[model samples]
Target: MLLSGQSHAATESRLFLDGKELSLPEKVEIENLDGNVMIPIRVVVENLGFKVTWNQKSQSVKIEQRDKVVQLVVNDLMATVDGKQESLNAAPLLRKGSVVVPIRFVSEQMGMEVDWNNVDKVVSLITPVIEPTIKEPVKVPPTTGSGTSSPTTAPVVEPSVMLSQVNTIQFSENQLKISLSASVQPKISRLTGPDRIVLDLPNTMFSDSFRASQGLDNKLNGRLEVSGYPDVSGVRYSLFSSSPSTVRVVIDLNSAKKYTLLTETTDSTLITVQLREEDSVNIDPIVPNVPAVNDGRKKVVIDAGHGGSDPGATSISKKMEKDFTLAVALKVEQLLLQEPAIELIMTRNSDVYPTLQDRVDLANNMNADVFVSIHADSFSPTANGSQTFYYQRTNSKAFANVIHKYLIKATGFKDRGVTENGFFVIKKTKMPAVLLEVGFLSNSDNEALLFTEELQNKVAQGIVNGIKEYLGIK
Candidate 1:
């Protein structure tokens, strides 16, 4: 099961040790009355945006809100909800003094929903409505190609994305004006075998026939340049587009140097190559241009934007964008985690809101192939549904297309249309990055559905599938 929770409540079954309904602790692990499975309640409740608590002295579990309290007794089959006699199908049992209940009945009664697969013996809980949840974003180190499947279920979650169709690249003019972020930097490496230079571009351009052009010999002379550059032997190039704002171009070089890069209007990527005299450069002119070899997978960075402090784009539902985004992000994470090759990373895993700059910084630092910032948009609840935004740049065109199609198919938000905006995260990111407005928080009708895990996962899965198509990975 890609998304599994502890034993969730099914029929409003609350545990009452006596006539007093007990409160459950926040983020505590509770076992079933049968004592078969221990469920981690933190992940579940966090997604649900509920307060959980445990009393060490009393050895009891309590979940309290502003007015209501749900209490459970250790090893006791009885529970109390707001101090009332409530019948329990399964009583709260004690484990080493702490009370635990079945995840099925409890999660449900506590204003959450659960899905059960009898055939597979799996239980998943969806928080009814996500409120304010704080989270932080951290960067993970690097890895190679050879992508594995995404763990949208129980097994895998990767930090990569794929590119599929190139929908459209709209330019205000025939030649679009695009700029790179100062924080956006590239890696320069030398390959051993072929005398070639490699360029790692953050994104692949949008064109029916678009690929990096590499040459070993100085083709400027048009002498059918073999590997004959005296200063540099050859060059290899590749571009992977995860978002409109991202692409990675790896230029294989004959020798290594401290290079400064600049892209000019003539479409020539100038690499002021300064190599050490320590190595002799070899060039090969006869070799044909090579295609970039992907690990055959893409990295997915599911950003639960606006955690801890900054809650971006709030709605009238009193539902913080931070919480809604986290809930959806979790769903996306769970769904992608099942895939073996698809590595998953959350820009914000908890309620803490991460800064826009830090969010982009993580993606860049991690060297993520693709970055998707999940956000629940808000306006007048009357103005509901979802729409995605990308930077107004030509480089991000391909990345935007792949994600655009998939989001429409998955979320089914009002096709607000893909437009250009100068969002801080996407523009500043060094990699292919896109900001997704899952749905309008201002829209009341859409918010109801937005709170569900099923819908959230479906949307998440759609994004994953879209990435897969872009990368040409099954």
Candidate 2:
């Protein structure tokens, strides 16, 4: 059994089981509420050779070891220890997907002694040792032809290696070098939405010297900021898991780029990540051209947020935010096309990804009058509303306020109001720009409403109305 202090206090406090220090998993922290030291129930109970189970229907937790069993309900001050009712100073609660309980109560009930050092703010759990019974080994009879039996031997195992250091260099290519005590193959993968390349090193741990060099204490993660590199932004490393001991290194990228792993030999201890701009390929390009009609029509650029490899936010029904944004943008385009006083330009017309820079360049080159980027918000499931965002510019705020009025009316959801934010599309564009968070994808009601064609048409009309009102057109 082991006990840890509260989340705020746990940063400086140390946790010890017997005499050895333990490292808590990332995002799992002990919390103290009132006077009780709360700990994640699964972390402490499961490590003490106990089986922990949860009942989803009843919202309760059960822990069993041999004939002893303990049960706890969420937000209930009473618990059951072997069919006998027991009172608790504080009830168990859930935080960040883990159930936390009073550490002292759980530790004592599980037949362990808990000690808290006030001076050092250290938590220690002492378990009683059970002696194993010894039995005499049976001797085998000697072989008929052999005088002595062959001596038995145990196989020797090699110690696991550790990652020693990480460094970056920028020359013709952005290079990331990882040093290790021994050679190991790294598993590589890619992620989008602020693109990144991930490298996973198996059976490795961070060395003490490397931890000290990176200013990492018991926390198993650190980041290094890289400057003067175009494609590469920063490098992050962490102890991803403990049972199999996997270390993960993520290379943050400003955009999608091509990379290669360089090593001298199969057993080389140095792994180099060579990053370079992806080879340019010709595709359908957006032509920055003004309308030839010479009529004094205001040019508006409609941007759909994320597409292609980037799905943006996933809705409650698992629908992609890109799909919703594109759908709404197309409807807005249809509405604006019928108007004689408006000229429309779309950042993306299909299921394609236009980088933030690409969108900004197109708007700037064409000299648009107003820019509106369509996107659906995402957060907790309970977060559902309509809002608009603008950068710090005065004209942008006026643009956002006008658009938000009609947007809230169209969505008919909660009015979250207009706010100021430095969104890339809105901030970089020279014209009056506003990014509309039409509704939340995480909310079931909003997701269903957004998929309806009637609502899409209404929202498109509202956006056009807002634009016309801002431009002083009837």
Candidate 3:
């Protein structure tokens, strides 16, 4: 009677209570099985002012709220509501060590309204308001009817501020703008690990149009993907809490950079976040091969294409191109480090992505003698070979020819030869640069060979030899 197999592949459903999103316990999830939205019993009932208890002996659960009581047995279609037997579309069950029950049955039986948004996979439960019943005045109130009673006024409650738009704009600088229907004091803080900037707006909710535009119905959370901007990865927003009606907005950052929050004096509904480039002094410590005073050693910058969030290509076996590129680039660095006559610089030593402009700037600012970028290509499965590319400028073609010769020999694939291409990194760099596509990741045979450590070492050695031969080093 337990759910198994492909039923677990169903998308996890989001739970909301009276329009506020409820954070589920870790490892406990809301699931849709056979079209029935199953929600964790304890999470939903407790939020609705109900007490829940488990009976291990009978494998049953009891939920109580005021004078009402509901009991459900595991894998049983029959449930008891106030001692009355009722049928269920889907029986209560255990998922990820938590008891989950059918949202509609449990919610409706407890005098709560239940709504499901199938498109967005959201389950909304609304608790009905209970108004106090008025009793007829007694005969004693007639004695005081001669004196008029003064009516007391109720306190006014302000409506929640609406978050109308969250968008990015490019003007003099890249700015993230948040539009609101009213003014709000936002709590701002910075987080690390994967760097992010978080802003919390009090008493705010997403406007109807904004929510619908995000494809969210009754769901209080969504994400916006920012394209063409190098500093930012994406933006995420959610109704963080319901008690105070707080909205949380998180900005995912690519790297550590200075940002300014612009507050409008006359218009308080608009919030602007401006991104600024990191200071040179703050940047030098993290960047490799930035010389305070050069001693005339030849500088070479090694770039490993695509990393972190950007996986360049997927191999036939599903290996990432970023991993292969970094592996070979590191091996080449190790081989080149032993030479006293050559100075080595790496675009990235770890699995992190630097923007293409960042890579070009690093080489140009360091005044590197040569620049080389490593990448794995993806095309038809039948395509297998090694190729190198260079922009049509200076001695770039000659630089590519020297590297391609060694690279083709090490890879032992069909030689694709050197070609001219206007790749961003190679074209922007001031000195001679070449982008090497070592092997076709889509080809099974080449993918298998490229992943081997022995082949990576050979490829690394070939690249070092090519750089040395090009520079007339022994």
Candidate 4:
């Protein structure tokens, strides 16, 4: 019923510019997925001085502003900004025959600022006059009850409240409180393998200002270990979804404990997770699951291409990219296991999809020396080759060059050569990262080779050798 209530609120979502409400076209309503707001292309694009065109043949949408051309394919998470490719967590969708795109990506790409007020289900837009400034919190009264009814044909949910901040309150050693910006009920769940509690805050957005303040080097973004703490280890939070607008807050604990949610407040809401010493018994402090290597072993995180819902590319023989990538990643893991001087981390070992943000977070949190992402290529059958890609970073090129040389030598697939592109996993990672397109799934020759265990082992060896060379290992 709460979820349904939020849905009703979303259907009546509105937009404002400098305090003035703007009229939106029909069926072209604004929707929120995860924490990002999506707006109809024609409404947002035409207003920003860009011409919008739909290519029916390609089933894609194009927006041209100034000299920039943006292309997005329906149901696909990959988009081309300028001329380079970028990954999107949420793909463009068609609702009631209208095209909608994630507003945050398009607006920022088109050079505009975006803000959201969840309580009123309103979004704000502005053009920066000088350096952008963070708006002081506008404490709006929370709306109650389901919103006005909509047509039966439309079932889309719109944006809700923004989750502005997450801060800790330490009453004493045994007591801890996690506070959220606005008053809203959130769902809580517990997990054992990692020994943590997850709080799913629906209809929420992780505030931009909080992220900027925390940046990359701070207590919020990095591991926060309070000295002499017995029950709690660290706390982490991330934007989990936009469709329902949920923000997940993860509290890493020393052991399981009873918790309580307190929403009986007029202002901010708090969730008190009891972390008393009696709750934990000889629990180990959270450490990297990676096996310990020599003192100076190079740490490498091998990210298998696509998995779960996103099968990267399919072969004529119906071989999924997910299977090939996992097979090769496992082989690479096997080869690396033979070396005592190198520690390896696999982004995934099973059939599952990890968001681009999650992959980068794992590498950065581990302080890995280098990051390698493996994938099979897609394109026309004639476009058969192996290509290594690195973003525009100094160390990225060197990593690509080393890995590509060995890969090309081993595969003997046409050398598509090393390329410079803004692929998501490579671009966001702090350490040296490269995405290796092992072979073309579109080509019969390459597909057959990729299916064989012998070739997969060779590809794995190539990656292992390149990592060794990059780390200066004999």
Please write out the lDDT profile of model 3 over residues 121-206, one tens digit for every residue: 77766553221111342222111001111111112223442333432211111345576776555555554435566666656667
Ranking by lDDT: 3, 2, 4, 1
CA-only RMSD, every prediction: 27.6, 24.5, 21.6, 23.0
Range of the 10 consecutive residues with the lowest summed lDDT in candidate 4: 145-154
lDDT of 3: 0.72
**Model 4 pairs whose backbones collide:** 10-158, 33-242, 33-243, 34-241, 34-242, 34-243, 35-242, 118-161
Model 2 Cα lDDT, one tens digit per residue, 1-474? 135435455466566665556665456656567878776777666666678999988889999865578999989989998898988889988777778888777655664345565556566654432211113433433211111111111122223433333322212114566767765566565544446776766566787766776655454777877643446688877776443455777788888765667653533566666554444533113333333345788888999888887677678788998999999999999989998888899999999998888898998877888899998976545557898988656777888899999999999999988876545677678778898989988789999999999999999999999998987778
Error of 1 at 174 (Å): 26
Best by lDDT: 3
State every prediction's TM-score relative to the real structure. 0.38, 0.43, 0.41, 0.41
442-464 per-residue lDDT for model 1 (tens digits): 56777777777777778878788
* Top candidate by TM-score: 2
Candidate 3, residue 62: Cα displacement in angstroms equals 66
Error at 50, model 4, angstroms: 23
lDDT of all predictions: 0.49, 0.70, 0.72, 0.67
Question: Looking at model 3, which ten-residue stretch has the lowest summed lDDT?
Answer: 142-151
TM-score of 2: 0.43
User: In model 2, what is the error at residue 252, expressed in angstroms?
Assistant: 7.8
Clashes of each: 134, 1, 0, 8
